[model samples]
Target: MITSLDHLVLTVADIDATIAFYTQALGMTHAPFTVADGSTRHALRFGESKINLHVSGAEFEPKAQNPTAGSADLCFLTDRPLADWQRHLAAHGTRIEEGPVPRSGATGPLISLYVRDPDGNLIEISAPLQP
Candidate 1:
């Protein structure tokens, strides 16, 4: 059985812009590592999770059947308050597509805000509802 997600890949249109958005807008850390073919690849790290980046047409082996940008809708849980996140996002000039609306998370109730990354991927940042 699967325990947890080690990492996931995102087929990005532009790696640099994706990195900048995730890093500056979302406050994730950017790390570059060498692949088996000795080429450098980028990843964004947050908590214990990481998202690897691959160019649109230049994906690594064993990739998704249709690795297209803007096709993903990812939700991330945050301990910080939604208000704080909103301010932070505003400071970064990131637009919130939706509000702190109620939603069901993988574990329990959650309030989430939606935003779009540079690649147009729907990014949901949520905080658990303290019922």
Candidate 2:
């Protein structure tokens, strides 16, 4: 049986820039050893889950790869509610696509917001499930 999620992989063009975005902007720390892997891997700590970033190549641009922008979506859990996430994103000028809506799924009702990284990969920030 599946216990919990370990991490999610994200392909980026600029590994160093992505690392800085996660570490500086998103408040994630770079895991050691990954830096020496040569693929420019980095992991951001999210509770017990980690967000893994992999450098594909110089020509690897997310926007170019994901035109529909629906290949994959990543979610982040925050202690604050949807309103807080909205404010934080606005303060940082993060793009919001579809979100903060009560989504119907296995997890029940959850509020979510969407944003993209510097590489133009769609990422989501979500508040804990609430009725």
Instruction: Indicate the TM-score of model 1.
Output: 0.97
lDDT accuracy of residue 103 in candidate 2: 57
Instruction: List the candidate 1 regions with Cα displacement exceeding 4 Å.
Output: none
Residues 8-122 of candidate 2: C-alpha lDDT, one tens digit per residue: 6676767787777667556678884433336444567767777665555433233245433224566666677777767766776666787876654446556778777777776
lDDT tens string, model 1, 103-130? Answer: 9998999999999999899999999999
> C-alpha displacement of 109 in model 1, angstroms?
0.3
- On TM-score, the leading prediction is 1
In candidate 2, stretches whose alpha carbon ends up further than 4 angstroms from where it belongs are 34-41, 58-71
Clash counts per candidate, in order, are: 0, 1
